[model samples]
Target: MKKIAIFAKVHDPRCLGVAEELVTWLEARGLEPVVEAHLARHLKFEPGTEPERIPDSADLVVVLGGDGTLISVARLIGERQVPILGVNLGSLGFLTEITLDEMYPALERCIAGNFQVSERMMLKTEVTREGEVISSHQVLNDVVINKGALARIIDLETSVDDYHLTTFKADGLIISSPTGSTGYSLAAAGPIVHPALDCLVITPICPHTLTNRPVVVDAGARISIILRSMNEDVFLTLDGQVGMELKAGDRIMIRRAEHRTRLVISQSKDYFEVLRTKLKWGER
Candidate 1:
């Protein structure tokens, strides 16, 4: 019997209902259903089942909530090299793209060891002040260095592969992976890149000069940003979940992380189908 870790958002009825159903289904099939602590109270689950417990014992991690919840759990199990299946119960989800109807079949394929695993890239971001490394973080999405709401426009000096790129006077900057190209990068007028591509996109937020457009960089290259303004409130955000404050004379670096997130995709689905369904592309 394969041990499966079940995680969901308790606030959503759809997620809660699905979690309960999955627990019963897994148990009937002689599989152990391990749920996250918070979701335990919502379902009629047996005692002594938790996320931490299952990650060590389970064969797979099944996340039934939105992208944010999945991201949280993914980070919790980071570098464990565990495969995760995301079922979307929220809106505009890029990570949690699987539908409710696809749940059981996906699980069945996992149990049968028949599925495709997409190795999505992650980013490692580091912040330095006065040449001293202060903070570091890992993000599956883009790394944004921008100014606060009340702060004035900021100046950022960017470089790719140690080669100086154009400086930007804008609200902020976004450095995103190909998998994250459809996210904030797309909203910032950046091109949408297929997830299979190995590339990084750099987009400026509200550039003062219209000539400064977004640029796509090679994935193997290193990206560096220098905070040129001495009197502005700048900040660094990771996957829009974690953030750090930036000071003048501070330098920020971004590169491909050593670890990757293994996402299980349905054999019947394609990336273009996801784009069309989620984005309503070419629709009147």
Candidate 2:
């Protein structure tokens, strides 16, 4: 309530303008508005705070962009329990559900501590090569393992909790948290799991076997995927934002994170409403 952080997608001019307006509004109410160093330069303010420091310094983080931008902030918050308010600059977003018209009202409730906070689960993903951990990332969405454009169908020998599951011969495999059910997992014919459920979904992308279907597993399950395809340009993408090239013998491990992302829900709408608006339910 005292120190507020503002982050916006610089690609959209409207987001930047709204961020500036938010700064002024927050300042007028005797609140300190701290901005990221890169965004501060664009807003004509002196740079003092870094993006990583937002979680530590700010009481609340207001994001002005789509779900992608909010996802980046979620990763930064990483176990910090800070609540994030996402304002959709354009159309209705899955994660960024709050609209421009409802921003101030939402902020008013948030400032007064009268708002509802929804806690969504996160995923801990890592890459291991030759029995050594090479890379690790915390994601609010799914962990994707796919091949490059030039590569053919890759093999992913997957398992759950030390049990051998199956070898999926497909273009990719999506290991998604329940909160990420509406994302790439849905596009790959995965089930739309409710965010409240603590579970994981494994969906194969364009599988060679028609019988290979998406499977929903317990949240405590640890998915171990071993890349068995050689001479293929395989990749491991995290939350559709950051990616890394994978070798043939590399191992991809995914598990439920210990912490969750606390999101400030839209005051006027619910999750079903969001699905209806975004997916156009009951429409011809």
Best by TM-score: 2
Clashing pairs in 1: none
Q: After best superposition, candidate 1 residue 172: deviation in angstroms?
A: 0.2
- Local accuracy by lDDT, each model: 0.85, 0.92
Listed per candidate, the RMSD to the true structure in angstroms reads 1.9, 0.9
Expressed as tens digits, the lDDT of each residue in 13-70 for candidate 2 is 9998998899999989999998977788888877648998889998999999999999
lDDT of prediction 2:
0.92
Off by over 4 Å in 1: 44-55
Candidate 1 local lDDT, 1-284, one digit each (tens): 38888888889998899898999999999998877777887775656466666667767888988888877776666677688899988887777777888989999999999888888888888999998999987777788988988998899999898899988899999999887788888999989898887888999999999998989888888999999988788989888888888899899999988888888886677888888988998899
Task: Tell me the lDDT of model 1 at 260.
Answer: 84
Q: Give the TM-scores of the predictions, in the order they appear.
A: 0.93, 0.98
